[model samples]
Target chain A: MMTAQIKEFPGVGLRESDFEQRKVLYTEWVPNARYAWDAGVAIGRYLAELKEGRLIGVRCRHCRRTVIPPRVFCEWCFRPMDEWVPLPDTGTVNTFSLCYVTWDMRRLTEPEIPAVIDIDGTHPPVGILHLLGEVEPQAVQIGMRVQAVWKPPEERTGSILDIRYFRPVREG
Target chain B: MTRKVAIVGIGYTGCRPLTAEVSYKELVYEAAVKAYEDAGLDPRRDVDSFVTVAEDFIEGTSIFDEYTPDQLGGMLKPNVTIPGEGIHGLATAYLQIASGLVDVVVVEAHSKASNVLTLPHITAYAMDPVYNRPLQANPIFIAGMEMNRYMWATGATQEQCAQVVVKNKRCALYNPTAAYGANLEIDDVLAAEMVAYPLGRQEISPHADGAVVLVLAAGEVAESLTDLPIWIRGIGWCNDAPSLETRGWGRAIYAEGAGKMAYQMAGIRNPMEEIDFAELDDTYAYKELQHLEALGFCQFGEAGILTAEGVTEPGGALPVNVSGGNLGCGHLLDAAGLRAVVEVVLQLRGEAGSHQLPDVETGLAFGWRGLPSTSGAVVILSN
Candidate 1:
């Protein structure tokens, strides 16, 4: 038998009755922690290219890995990414999720098929997460070919949303 | 020369869906008082320093460290705050004791998850603003995609993942502090509302509020404080990648790295045979299987099979989450890891009344900083 023992375990749980009846004193306040994040050199150029309906990745000399949604420094090599590489807008669905709920846990009438798409010109598995369309939810499979469907050129806002979503690439 | 460390005392306030009677501070204070009394030490006289685990965003307050000292008897003392899991805080306390700068260090971690009305939006803030955040989706989508990739890579079925929920929640029926214990079936999980593909509302751990405080002392001090000091055999923590674009989708690289580090320290070559049981982080059900593989308890894809065979049951060869994991006992944000520690300490000391296992020796506890973070920590403990 264990020699030591706890005499009392103290933790008061709030019952639903008490909470609903306003039995507990409470104060609510919100703190604003907003920021205009600096996109730096690589991401700055990447977002700029997105406005023109294209994709770019930064290539590291040391690691020989082209990182998309580019960064100036290679996280693995601890060196600057010195080269810019152009990437295709098409890729495969590495993985996907059909979300029936919104960001705040609200139910949605239509499900959102979010997928990590392996853009054709970038390295394997280094993919962007975007919604999938032009297919049934059950039809979406891992390794399925997909092509980015961009928003109209005038609708481009230098954001990831510039590419509306990814659609299955039908073979000829 | 470095000294050995031991967990001298432990105290916790809950595993409840909501701790409304007391504020988060009162919750910590109560737990701290219990811990100090258990160790037979006074905060001002015997304690040397303090370490707390919390996140500014989760707490809905900036510089949360400054708000904690009043509750943990840490005012005017050397207090340190880590915005990670509770085991990470424990690791910090271990360093202080091992450094010989402090003979007794107190560590605290808590979760007031119910207080946050905007959890998803706040969690969305963790996404890569310029690249990922522009999509304006909830962070839960990341977990859904990961689960899909893990299942694809490991051949583990969704039904197998549901078994974990059944096992853990059923186990929670016997635990006093657990909140969400239930006799659930895999079909119930499958038939539940789907939040994301292959991830259901039933499979995800719901939030809870709790507080845990631990007392740590090294070598002679540990020997003087408690007769049943649970010795810390090894500790490890690691991070893989912060970006969703760069991380490995199929495996938990961070857990694998952390397990290797802790095993090397504890001289454990075969974790499957050496460690008696584990309380791994299961914020998501698939994570339990993924971590089991990463921790060397089983080969990749073998965890689901082993779990199906009852190998991880309390009566089986290697019990896992017998105290009811976060799935069974509600998820306690930053404090969840410490709650797992409380279970480990109880089992190691033979004080776990209804949940105690026989002839147990070495035990393991693991914690992961959930969502958009690959950081994980592992600690090995023994009687």
Candidate 2:
């Protein structure tokens, strides 16, 4: 047995009835604030390119790697990226998950497929996280070929969602 | 000679699934009072400063620090808040003492996860708004992807991952402070529903409500105050890539870098032979294996074999997380690391009772800030 025992500190869990009774005693307020974040220079350009129905990346000359979800500055080299490069819509699934719950904590009957897709023409494994569509969950595998399914040109927004989702690439 | 900071006193309260009777401030006060009593010092006089750890989104309050000091008895004394884990706050306190800025300092952190109605939303909010958040997927999906990549890269089977849940959850059965202790077999774990592929519902830790307070003093002050001082032998923390795409998928480079710096400070050349045991972050079962490789406990992709051999079980060669880890003890968020610290202190002082290990002279602890974030911390304690 331990020589010195710290007494257990207990907490009273308020029951539903207790909450109802204490409603008059407590104060409640909902937060009301809206935000409009700027996508900034690199992401701003990336979104604009998506609006144009093209995939793009920035090349860090020093590291000689074309990075997607493009950044103006190279995180590794600490230098400005040299040039903009066009990337192919097709890529490989680096990894993926079958999600049964929604972001707001809702249970879903149809699972959401989220995956990291390594886009072509970018450096190896330079991927973007997005959803997988037009494929069964059991069919998804690491290294599976996939291609972006863009929103219609008229419906395109300058946001990442402009790429509807990725689908399994059909072979010739 | 460089000054050494030691943890002279510790206190904790409410390691349960929910704690509605007392508000978070009251919870902090309970721990602070007990810590002060144990150290035989008055926070009003003896303590020179205070540090509290918390995240704003989780608290649903901006500037959560505004509500911290009064309950900590830190009313007027220099008190600051770290926007990181509990052990990070301790690291700040350690720096304060080592810098000769103050002699005695107190660190506090607490969790009221039950109050969080939209945890997945808050987790998604932590992601990159431009690249990751718009997908609107559950944040656990990232852990699933990482787990899949880790298994594919290292050949670590799901069976090995399930075994971690079995070992840690059963370890909690002997821990009086653990809230989620259970008698779990690997088969039981394997049969659990998969939340994300490779990670079962049982493999993830449930959120817990708790608070931990620690009193740290300079070496001389510590020796004068308490005979059972757990010396901070080494401490380190690091961050990998802020973006998940660029970071290493199979291993935790952050924990590796942090553990390296800590080991260098402690003059430990070999962790496996020199360190007695560890209490690593096991928020997700696969994380325990990933962190083991990162912490240099074993070679790359070798934690599974060691675990299978019962080397990390209590009464085994390396007794990792005899207090049940986060898997059995519940995830305390920012307070998670300090909970590990509290357990290490108990084991070192031989006060762990039923879960006590024999002659535990030194211990190591690891804490991760959770998914969509690669931040982590490491601390070593010696009696």
Candidate 3:
């Protein structure tokens, strides 16, 4: 038999105040982790098109799957994807979350609706994550039709946010 | 055929919410000492190689593995670091021993999750710097979004997800190492402060601080160290596409692929029958159900129903996460998976007093490298 078998969890627990009371030296690190990730061949053109107020995707010759935020190579097919295709800014919500917190656990006064929008002309489940705007939080539902609300060309910086949040499309 | 590998010894330090008294180095030393003692071997003499799992950003240190040798008694030995999950480290150890170049291997994984001042900020860096990081939403929002898709596709409910918390935490009450064990009810989980819609604060696992070390040896080497060795029947790990946009949202395809490989290796034609129990990745409560479905323990949507019907309780038919899952035990970043292995080891050895189940021969430990990574691994063990 293994000796000194752990019958109880052997770790010392401390309260938040214990550090202050014990005068523990806590060091804070502010890391400047900056990187200019090359959007590469696929995303470079994709971002360029986004700045031009358009959406784009790539078609894989093997799987025939349309990849958005396009990649130079098809992940499933593991082959080069040279076909660039234009896509509509309109799409449907594949999934969404009404987040009440920010990246640093800070509370928000109003919940942010982060969603994965299935853009038109792409595979059903393949979508980019973006926020939803101009729709009631309660009114948001999965599969609701929406269109991207783009920023003015002057304010665009070839970033994903060039097309701001998506809004629910009203039926005529 | 590949040679066999067995986990002859195991030792763990914690699944505690905080471990401020000791530095992460001391925690690693304590765990390594216990593991060596349990295996009845000297690390410098008997162990051939060492593997530790860590990430530069998560540890608050660059080249973090450089500082590992002194504490593990691994000075001047072959030591490697994997920046993936605990099971990945273990798999590497298994591979080294199976190659016959090494007789025994040590695998270590730990988390001082409480050390990082801005954990969410560090986690944000893991997101796709191009598409996802710019969103700046809480990373737990990903869990909420998946939970929504899972529920929408499978008919799982908020209440059913809450029951997972209820069961896992209640199971934790009997587990000594589990930090967040509670007598939680479905309402308590449901009523807990909502952080992400369709997901409450209680549903998300709070981080814990701890280290786990396991000594694995090949056939004869294993028997020489311990009479009762938990044999590694099979191991499998897989990942989805690098980008979240390209993968299926509702299904744990990684788990499915990993399970298929592991089950095939173990000759498990029917997972629901051949496997005795599982300690799955319940990083979020819904993940337990999702992983269970992916592992073929039940149909896609039936796991939530099983949880609701008491089919997954400790004494129930499929008894999942008897060590309280992550919900009850508190998660340990990359080390969470190896902690689950310890629970299964104790149970197989009939050393899990109070929470031990009877007549159990085979068990499984599945782990996920949570958030912004869809990597998962599965290991099946038998007594």
Flag clash pairs in model 1: none
Residue A95 of candidate 2: its Cα lDDT?
94
Candidate 2 CA-lDDT value: 0.87
Give the TM-score of each candidate.
0.69, 0.69, 0.70
Backbone clashes in each candidate structure, one number apiece?
Answer: 0, 0, 0
True contacts kept of each: 0.00, 0.00, 0.00
Model 1 chain B weakest lDDT span, ten residues long = B18-27
Estimate, for each residue in B1-383, the C-alpha lDDT of model 3 and write its tens digit. 67799999898996988776666766777788889889998886788889999988887668988977766778788999989989999999999988877989999999888877777887777777667766777788888888999999999988889999999999999999899999977888889898888889999998998999999999998888788999999899999996868978899999999999898988998998998989999999999999999999999989888889999998899999999999899999999999999998988999989999999999999999998778999999999
How do the residues B229-299 of candidate 2 rate in per-residue lDDT, one tens digit apiece?
Answer: 99999999999998977988888899999999899999998898888989999999989999999999899
All candidates: DockQ: 0.01, 0.01, 0.01
lDDT tens digits, residue span A60-141, model 2: 8788899897866554543457999989999999999999999998999889999999998887568999999999999999
lDDT of all predictions: 0.87, 0.87, 0.87
Error of 1 at B90 (Å): 0.7
TM-score, chain A, candidate 3: 0.84
C-alpha positional error of residue B82 in candidate 1 after TM-score superposition, expressed in Å: 1.5
